[model samples]
Target: MPENMPGRINPEHITIVLNQPRYPENIGSGARAMRNMGFYNLIVVDPENFDLEKVEKLSTHAARDVVEKIQIFDNLQKALSPFNYVVGTTARLGGQRQVNSPSVMAEKLIPISKENNIAIVFGREDRGLSNEDIRLCHGLVNIPTADFSSLNLAQAVMVICYELFNAGTKKKHDFNPRLASCYELNGMYKDLKDVLIKISYINPENPDYWMNYIRKFFTRMNLRAREVGIIRGLIRQVNWYGQKMYKDGLDHKKNQEADL
Candidate 1:
């Protein structure tokens, strides 16, 4: 097995969006968390202080890559438009929009991200993302905390990235940064969805409901790309064998009829 980070595989594509961030140290700390959790992409959108040195200091040695490669964007939309899915992290809740717990949100994102470039946008430290900002996101990610919950910017990033990292492994040297791409997992889902549709287990039109359930169910399994490929290949083989059996049965029946 590969050296495990958080999810065993680094997320193929993930962008952390910080809008009007106040502190440089938080940025550094967040970057550090990203490196530790096997992430490299960091974006700062119109922050108060864009100090690379501060970020480097807070990021420590592990997160140097993230800080070095940081992308600066003029606004949130510009940063997020490229990604297919976005998850916003915030502390506030109770509005027209429904928010999910971090655990639930993480599971929901795992498979989707496997098939899409996923972005997690965080708002300002003092106030968190605005309602309009939250609306831009596909879903909300709320870390579990007390009634009066408060989390530092870096801490929040740490929590979310840690969720993606699979069980930590002791064999540090075997670590490979390559994660399953969105295309690969997309194919797996398509394969699984096809089987389910053919088996008449799912209503083809309203597959999202079932798919969401299945996505969460399978995400917890900590599946990797190679494992997904194995399953996909097996499914195809099973389908092929089933077709062969049916063809053979038809030929045998015709032969008997001719003899008769």
Candidate 2:
């Protein structure tokens, strides 16, 4: 940990999202945990008959403001729309999911939170994140346990928040980079896919197969806004040139027809 960067990220920049939380007590305690670690923003998505009184009671005055100001959303995607970097927490994980421990994630998150809105999403009490829900997130976080891996909703929240707070308190470098937002990245990828399709670089029937690979490639780069803009510009140029060549070939064909 370097010492140059102090107070790099504010608590306001980080949001804790509980998706379809079954118990108000859990939500309350989760808020309490966040408050303990200096985080305020809380978003509840499709909660199950949550009781404000229960929340307030369990929060124990620590997170009264958080409980009162909690944002509610019907859809997970809409709930996460405002955030540029979204990380989903999961107990069971496999496949293409890249799950990082809380400590590792905390280090990566600190710098990004300084420049963009960050959301750390916790799933339901019964089951963890669905495949669809996980897909929306930019990354995954997993809390390691001994034999019994399953953790209570609030407990999981506390572990991750604690790591983030601990990481923030430590010495850090002045690593403020102008990274592209998720919205901008999505737009750039769309344009890239279009250009790739136009040039027959990717199969039209399953462009996402190639696009997912490309997305993974870019995610590692932590691409800056200017880098994304340059890539988009390059795609546009390629598309323009491809269109020109096609039009020129058509003109040549018409000329041959006229000569004959």
Candidate 1 off by > 4 Å: 1-10, 167-260
Candidate 2 lDDT tens digits, 86-191:
8999988678878999998988887787777888999998898997788667889999999988899999999988988877545555567756776777789889
Model 2 stretches astray by more than 4 angstroms = 1-9, 48-54, 168-172
Number of residue pairs clashing in candidate 1, backbone atoms closer than 3 angstroms, sequence gap of 3 or more or interchain: 6
Clash statistics: count for each candidate: 6, 0
Candidate that scores best on lDDT: 2
Candidate 2 residue pairs that clash: none
For all candidates in order, the CA lDDT equals: 0.74, 0.86
> What RMSD does each model have against the real structure?
10.3, 3.0
